[model samples]
Target chain A: MNDKVAQTVKTKGITRRFLIIFSVAFCLLLASASTHYFIVERSERIERETRELLNIRLGKAAIERDMQDVISDLTFLARHNETSGIFLPDNLDARQALAQQFRVFSEQKGRYHQIRVLDETGQEIVRVNYNNGEPIATSETLLQNKSDRYYFTETWATEGRNTYISPFDLNIEHGEIEIPEVPMVRFGTLMFDENGNKRGVLLLNYLGSTVIEDFREATANIADHAMLLNSDGYWLSNVEKDREWGFMFGRNDTLAEHFPDAWQRINARDTGQFSNRDGLFSFTTVYPISSSQGNLGDGLGSLPADTSYYWKAVSHLPPQSFSASLGEFLRRNMPLYSTMFIFLAASSFIVALTRFHHRQAVSEVETERSFRELLERRVDERTDELKTAQVEKDLVVQHLIQAEKMTAIGTMASGIGHEINNPLYAILGLAEAIRDDDSREQARGHAGKILSYTKDIAAIVRNLTGYARPFSGTEHKPIDINEVIHKAVSMVKRSLYDDRIEFRTDLGGLPGFSAHSEEIHQVFFNIIRNGVQSIEDDGSLMITSRYDGEKIVINVKDDGKGIAPEDHSKVFDPFFTTKDPDQGEGMGLYVVHQIIQKYKGSISLESVVGKGTTCVIEFPILPSVKKGNP
Target chain B: MMKQKILVVDDEESVRETIRLQLKSTGHEIIEAEDGKQAILLLGQSNSHGVSVIICDVRMPNINGIEAVSFFRRDHPSIPVIVLTGYPDIKLAAEFVEKGIFDYVVKPVEKERLIAKVEKAAIQSAVMNIVD
Candidate 1:
């Protein structure tokens, strides 16, 4: 007896151990799923941010290309003697001619700041500025004396083959004396004579703020920071210049320190890109400056691409910047972690509850063992209780289905009503006018007839309203099936007809029958319309109806495109339209199925992809009730 | 006898045809234009002379029916204009009425109702002609 008790105790302990282990495993699984969800969400956000940064970088690169193109055009035009003649010693004829040319160039480009010509020796010859009549300055000093300047040295050394773009400066002046102060970013290109002799340099200065302004205007909504930097780590343009570039430049640190191997590669190869430790990615492209003048060289002597234009290097910053505020980063990620933590807590609670329940069951089993017959009787009672529970569950399911149907019907009714009301207003207005007109006898007679017809219109409206909300188990009535079909087709077609999809009706030989006409009409309309949409290209839909002894058979078939076999069964499921979620609620076929079932009809579908789909509906015909002569 | 000219304005050719067919039995001359822009050009050219009434469908692509009616009232006050609309909102109806629209008709238009409205508009126009 002592050994039997020991065995029972050991069995109970083993059961308890199993319950605890199972509960812990289940809780761990739940926690793992929650963690995975958090990780996936975080990764998606990071990816989106990375893409945005890439787009911004590409946009900036395009803008820079355009600026270079403009500069090149100015350089080419300036090489002509007729173009440079304006810069010659204050000759009225030449100055006026140059001013006219400048006006045309400015009008065409919409943003050229000034055009200036410099002698081969680097002395300013003549200039036209866009500062609303600012005074023009000439270099009295010898051009040879200032050969060290980038504009002069590059032009002279490259033998008029290079163009120079100057950095942003505040006090640059251009054109006539009366104009306002022009804060300019200047560019200069050399001009060579036909004999290859260095002639002069053509300089164009544009508003620096305007260049940055255009970029900012184009990307006003982008949230990421954008900055322009030189190979020497000089800040070119930044929205918050002092905060971002100021801090970096003040430290005199190589970009390699901040960007790591990526910056090192960019400097080594003149172009490189990499993602930061935090997964912030960056792309950098560098174009070599052929001369100290910041001039891009032309395709002379194996210079990378055409350097005759200013070489530009572009780079996109990574999505996760080390410079991001710790507070903001934490805030953005808190939701994911919080969700995971909540899931963990819930799972733990469930584990605890399950452990308690298992202990209770063990204790109950021990107590029940003392009354074996009583326990068997209790089990029988429990089985009966389970049957009652199942019945209740079925009732709940029925109620849920009804509620869902009502909700769907309500939504569809609102959409249809809104669509129908527009036409109804026109009918109402025309009818009212007829009633008010007391003109010629013939006209008045016509008006009288129209008034009666409008009453028929009101009746149609009433029918539509009733049809939109048919009660469950409503008795089927004798209805003209052909008219219902025509009405439904016309209703849907009138609203959606466009250049893309032409509605073609092959509706032939539809017989009049007795059934719930409105319901059947909705079913036919929904199915036919769906078929029409399935054929995206210009296609034809053939709808045919025939009487098959005791039943009416209707077939809707499309010829443009067909549904995949896998999706065929899913088409009739609720919220399962192949159309975009925004365009369709996917409930059309589901509603049609419900209506057909309600009217004791059966619907079947057959489809072949790239060929077409056909839907056949069969409905029982009801006997018509004749109205007594009234 | 001169054919009674009827001006029809709708964005849709099919909708215009639906009305045209219903009015064909009346033996009136039917003139159709797609939108207010085309209707204005036709009216300006006097291509639809002796036009008994103008029937315009609202919610057209460019200028709507109510706006077209207002334009007609301003340019040709003697011409009675009817506004046809699918939307029967009270606010829109009130706005059309204020613009001196001869009538407003709704869509899925009852064929007979539309005919009667057109006939009444024609008679009113005739009475105005007699008064003038």
Candidate 2:
């Protein structure tokens, strides 16, 4: 029963169910979050790199287009009638006029640093420097020889219609850069005679600041940096101004030195993108700076070039640029958003569920505790009810035993009356003898006899009154079984002789058990009378008593016409008797059984048909009933 | 005058002594017996003071007053038998008379009444003995 209750407790355990829900929800949330993160990470990275690549392409293309436009301008100057000096044919006055025309052209295009013409002997012909949008023609003595200059020498190697682009450099005057360093790139084209003979070369120095300004304009909306690298892997453009163009001042820091991994990938591909912790670098080669949108070597300036147009443009985007698509994904996808929302809702629910279950578990404990207390109280109440009922039954049986005693005495009334009247006869007769006819001595003796006989009658009356005494007291008294037995025997002595049944008793010395003397005596009387009456003629009735350590044992054995074996068990039942109605009222053994049961005792009969019957009664010694010792 | 021998029968010695003392004053010779069977045995002995009357108690250990009354009526019909019993019911008295007993008296009768009945019964028995 207790195990069943425990099983119910487990089945209703709110805490266990809550834990199961919580664990499953947590694992599901963890799994969903990890998968979402993986997909979003890859997508966001690709979007960021594409954006950076587009910005780099735009910035790089702008720089290349500017160079192409500058080449067109130089080509126009080289082909012009006045500035090319084709009409002069080595005329000194025309040459001076051409110089003046070149200065006019330099002033028109303000982005140029210098414009100059050189003769076949590498002598300075005409030169003009446009300083910050102001054209200033250098005098004859200020013009330097162009013989050792690579731009001039490299132009001599060109055998066909071509242009020589100089390596990007800072402008120097008198072997030192002027007060502020001026970055420049020169675009030079060889002059041709009308007969296809080479004349002097035309060179224009372009301001490098136009490239930086154009890159800035193109990448203005982009939140990342762009880089331009020359073919030799030199840094031509970078976010850090100091790190750009390291080769110009002989610092020689290559793109590979700063971003080796990005340089290797960009170096191998014409257009590609890579992302790292510093963010994305997407690059494309924007060489030749031409309007043809093809290789510059394919045009009329294909031959006699010392170097090709060789710069690539790269955009550097930080890691955050890649997060735009991820943020957009968060905004647009309702299912993913709902998943997140559900996770949040489920988390809240779990917390609430835990709290709710905790409260439920606490209440369950309280309920179980109260239930146990109620059960205990009910059990105690039932025990008390049983005790009260037992006490009431004891009282009823006691009254019945007393009633049975009276009934037994009633049955013996005639014999008892005779017994009393016999004593009375002796008393009255002796008294009259003493008074009237006797001698003085005889009278005295008769008086003594009369006193004794009257006393016997008094004793017999005492026994009857004791048996019929209304049991008033509920408190138990200690009574000797021996004394109760003897008194019971005396009450039935006359009846025994009337039936010619011999009565024998062996009463052992016994301790006092708590009981009503009247009830115990009545029990003995009922049992002994039943024994005496069972006999037809000349039967002997034997009663014995003893103590068996923890119990008092009493046996009433009779050698009479015994009972049938089947009737033996029922003999103690109320109104169960084999004798005729007038000879026996069957309540005798029943009352005896009841009185013994009041003491928590047991009774059994051993009887055989025609042999004999023996009734054994036993009582457990109560705790208060120790052996009566000295 | 020859003394009339009387049979005294009772289980209680006190009752027997009471009867003896009552009869001693009357000068009748009393033969004491504890029960009716003893009384009948003594009657059978027939001493020179032959018993003229028998007084038997009804409730006795060996043989009761009822059995002894029938015995004398059969075997010694000449002797008059009187029943001296402690408990007396009308039916039992009728039974004794039907069995031809001379008289029945309950216990504790007056001393004079008891002696008169015994003397009357003895005289009646002696008168019958002459005719028999």
Candidate 3:
């Protein structure tokens, strides 16, 4: 199983593929995560803006409801003439009672700037201020312009109902004191008899700053500007109020400029939401407050039957701002993520390298084993081949040795034949010469006497040639020593007769020996012949045969020049003849020695330089043989 | 004087006949012994008849010619002896020559040479008789 795993690892490029897959997957995951974070940040900004818009619109609606309630209360007091006839009553008690009621009504409305009652002729009959000061004569100026004032006109136009005024300023004076002008949001109403006859008018004013305060409180968590604007493209309230409405209107304008477009769309119809050029997202919800009450002023006549009380709740969250924070967070954590990735990649690389190394090691071991097996087989084959060749070489060498021996024997045979031929020729010539002699009548008898000697000579020659010839067969016989000696001397005599060398034979009776007779004859002839040729002048060759208990000994002693001392031992060595090459083939003594050894005999030589040389040979007699045996 | 008689002993008859013919032609009476035994017997007979010299081959059958000469010296030392031979046997012949024999010759005998040696032997025999 482990081996299989190793094979799989080797074939699959597993580590490389794994690293490639891991890196690609990790990069994809990182990219997707980054995209998701970006989308979420953008969506969070959008959602936060939307939530701020809804909150600001809810706050503006609450303020519009409060204004409607104040208008209705003032219209009820004017129609009853309880609060409107405060300044028209002649009695001090009645005037005091109406003024007290107006002051109580103004105090009950929290956003009101002032409350006042005017006569049918547009004189300011009574006034109530939130600061609680006595009315001055200049407060009557508001009544003089009652036809232009939203409070008087709205009350006269709307027969007996409350009316909301457009946002404006109010002039109020107390006795000998002028009250500061207050920008107001006002409402008015007129009193009427039961028969619908016109009565005195009622007016109520609210502080415009109060609307911006409510919007700011509602959208505080939204992270953008907030404002409210009316239908005439005027800001009812802006959180940043110091800037002109124009500065908030264009692409390069302030946060308040986005309010008018938002408000106009709201006032033209129902609620609407938009993103403006000043980087504000605004939602305007319109609550249509009833302006039928005369408490709302003259501008109420321009209001739709359902008056658009526009509350623009605008909030902006910038894309650039959220992305900056997200980028900072990523930068802070980048080193940690990168370090983790590097560690994982390095471990993967090390594992791949180790697996590669293991595969190489295994392959090397397998290759080495195969190589060793091949080497062993080759060595075995070579050794077998060498042994076969060695055996063949030995066979060739044996044949070569046999061939050399045959060549040597052939040379010796030719030499021996030549040596013996000379002697036989001499003997034949001598015998013929004796036979041809005719000088004396007795010479014929002498010729007849030599016939037997010539026959002996011929017999000796035949025996020599037969011995000198290579063996044709194997045979052994008892041969007389006397006869072999006589033949040897006769042969030597025939050859050396011209040298005047004399040969003497002493044949002591001896038991005959069993041997190859022709071979022994050749041995004797070769030795005696060599002795006869050694002499330079007249000399004697003495040959003797005797018996030594179990052996027959033949000695050939020569008075010729003796052998050299140095040459004595080597004389029997093959090719070591002392004679001249033309007369001797150096094989005579060597063959003699070999034949003697074959007969279980021995030959020895004793010599003196001027005296002689003697060669003695002894052959063991066979106990079972007689002299005449074949 | 009767022709000077010469005795020739040789075991070889051819050698003996050759020497006899050669000496006979030279006006010497030739006597012969076929072997050493015959020559010894003949030498004893011829000594009484006044034989002047004896010529003999040294090698013979039964008794050698040199031994016959020794016998002759003992029995009749004054007779002159001449040795003849078919082959050279100088050492054996030199013995007889030293013993005051007539002379020695090797055969095939030269006729003039034999006659000369015979004349010298005859003179020596006469001087020896006078000395006796």
Task: Output the number of the DockQ-best candidate.
Answer: 2
Q: Write the per-residue lDDT of candidate 1 for residues A1-630, one digit (tens) a residue.
A: 999996787566655655576567656755765576556556755664565456555545544654666555655566555344444466657655665666666656655666666676666655555544443333234222444567566555553455566654444323232224333556776666556655677777666556556555544544345545555544455455443233233655435455556555545543334555634434343332332223434433332334433322334445444334334545776786567666655655565556756776887887778578677888889878987986786455434444443444443443344355543443444444455545567456555555555665576567555655544554655666666777766655544422245455554444455456655666766776677667775667777777655677888888757888889889878778777564467777777777677567889889889998889988775544332111
The per-model lDDT (C-alpha) reads 0.60, 0.76, 0.61
DockQ-wise, the better of 1 and 3 is 1
TM-score of chain A of 3: 0.48
Candidate 2 deviant stretches above 4 angstroms: A1-368, A383-391, A431-445, A471-480, A497-499, A507-516, A547-552, A567-585, A590-603, A618-630, B1-9, B17-33, B39-56, B64-84, B87-132
Best by lDDT: 2
Lowest lDDT sum, 10 consecutive residues, model 2 chain A, at A289-298
lDDT of candidate 3 over B8-107, digit per residue (tens): 6765554555565555555777777777788777765735367767776555556666667788777777778887653344554567777666677654
Error of 3 at B49 (Å): 48
Which of the two candidates, 1 or 2, achieves a greater DockQ against the reference?
2
Q: After superposition, how far is residue B110 of candidate 2 from its true place, in Å?
A: 5.4
Query: Residue by residue across A192-306, what tens digits does model 3's lDDT show?
Result: 5456656566676666545446555655655245555445445445545444243223323433355455445545554555544434355565442542322355443433354
Q: Evaluate residue A302 in candidate 1 and report its C-alpha lDDT on the 0 to 100 scale.
A: 31
Candidate 3 interface RMSD, angstroms, 1 decimal: 11.9
Error (Å) of candidate 2 at residue B94 is 9.6
Candidate 3 residue A332 C-alpha distance from true site, Å: 7.6
lDDT of 2 by residue, A220-288 (tens): 656337677788787666667787667767886887887788788888887887777666778887665
Put the candidates in TM-score order, highest first: 2, 3, 1
lDDT of 1 at B16: 71
Candidate RMSDs in order: 54.2, 15.4, 20.3
Q: Is candidate 1 or candidate 2 better by TM-score?
A: 2
